[model samples]
Target: MKNLFFSVVVMGLAACSSTPPAPDWQLEAKGSMDRAVAAYLEGNSRVEAAELARARAQLSRTGRADLLGTAELLNCATRVASLVFEPCAAFEALRPDATPAQLAYANYLRGQAQPQDIALLPAPQRALALSAGSGAADPLPRLVAAGVLLQTGQASPAVITQAIDTASAQGWRRPLLAWLGVQARRAELGGDAAEAARLRRRIAITQGSAADAPKVLP
Candidate 1:
């Protein structure tokens, strides 16, 4: 009887040890998105692509997709792809009924393909787009807005500076680097060699650090 009881207990322990824990889809999705953004910022296109695939996989496992969350993922993908490919189709496919923050991001993405449309957007929409990520919980929009404003010649240096400062304070390394790149371009255009050189140096340091960081996706 003692031998039989001991075997039963051992078998129960093995069963328990072999059973896998349930997955946390939400955490998986968030981590995937974070890693995607980090990879994109570091200019690691291969890693970015893999991380986005992972994000989509996580979202798929959640059973029901969150429209806004999906849109955010698409936005990041579009932004990164814009570096080497035309992303207007993906931008255009984003849902129109997003929240104010999301709408702002959509508009910024749209602006990349159609500056004229951006100019014709309603004043309120433009305002939201310009201030998309500022004072918001997410820092990506601010970076997007700043890039849009700088590229479109819609924002003054002071406004861009404020966006950069806000992103920096929020510890958004990627957006901060993007904003600095824009400033560097503007400096070069204006014949401010010293300013351009300083900005480039900062960009190099930031990119190096980001590249050295470990991959965050599972």
Candidate 2:
């Protein structure tokens, strides 16, 4: 009876454990923006537009206007706009908060920023490491970081290579492709011409010929 009582008490305590709050506007906005971009990239324009709309609405509701200026939020807006072919809206959205790196990334995604700008913001450099800001399940900030790396030209070789290598070793291939694709363009700008070419070739093969690969052809 005592053991049962103790076990019940422990279970009750565990059930009562508190969860942390959501991130502030900066992280929240970035996360929403990242989802919008991902939807766009995956050719889901409806979901992309909805996410972008949600992000914009959330940003508008925020009393903390300065949160938009952070590296995370602005980059997310830029990536979503670029993917959805809404460059003007994207630039307008980020203009108020654009850091030099952020602006450069936006412009590069829009085909206006210089290649050098992209190269400078490498994969490792672009990631805005979030600590204690958001929950681990929130992939938004990481997705935004990935976008920054992508916009700044650190995606292909280092970023994708790292993800693939990690995924291969960990058997985490499902999320790896989408995550790595977000960063692949960086290699295209960072002077890894051969690597970039190879990556593009792989992408093309996947897009064009993946269906042809022998599987249960039924």
Candidate number with greatest TM-score: 1
Tens-place lDDT per residue, model 1, 1-218, is 11211121121111222346535654555566567766665456777788777766765664442332443534353353222124445324544533443443344454553444444433433544545424442344444555555556676787578766765675555556666766788888999999988888877666575544322211
Using Cα atoms with residue i matched to residue i, what is each candidate's TM-score against the true structure?
0.55, 0.37
Alpha-carbon runs more than 4 Å astray in model 1:
1-23, 42-46, 61-74, 77-105, 112-127, 130-138, 166-174, 209-218
* Tens-place lDDT digits, model 2, residues 10-114: 211122224665446534555666566555434455666777776666666664333343323343343432222244454466567555655554554443445
* Candidate 2 TM-score, true structure as reference: 0.37
Question: What is the C-alpha local distance difference test score of each model?
Answer: 0.50, 0.42
lDDT of 1 at 89: 51
Instruction: Give per-residue lDDT, candidate 2, residue 208.
Output: 43
In terms of lDDT, the poorest run of 10 residues in model 2 is 4-13
lDDT of 2: 0.42
Clashing pairs in 1: 133-142
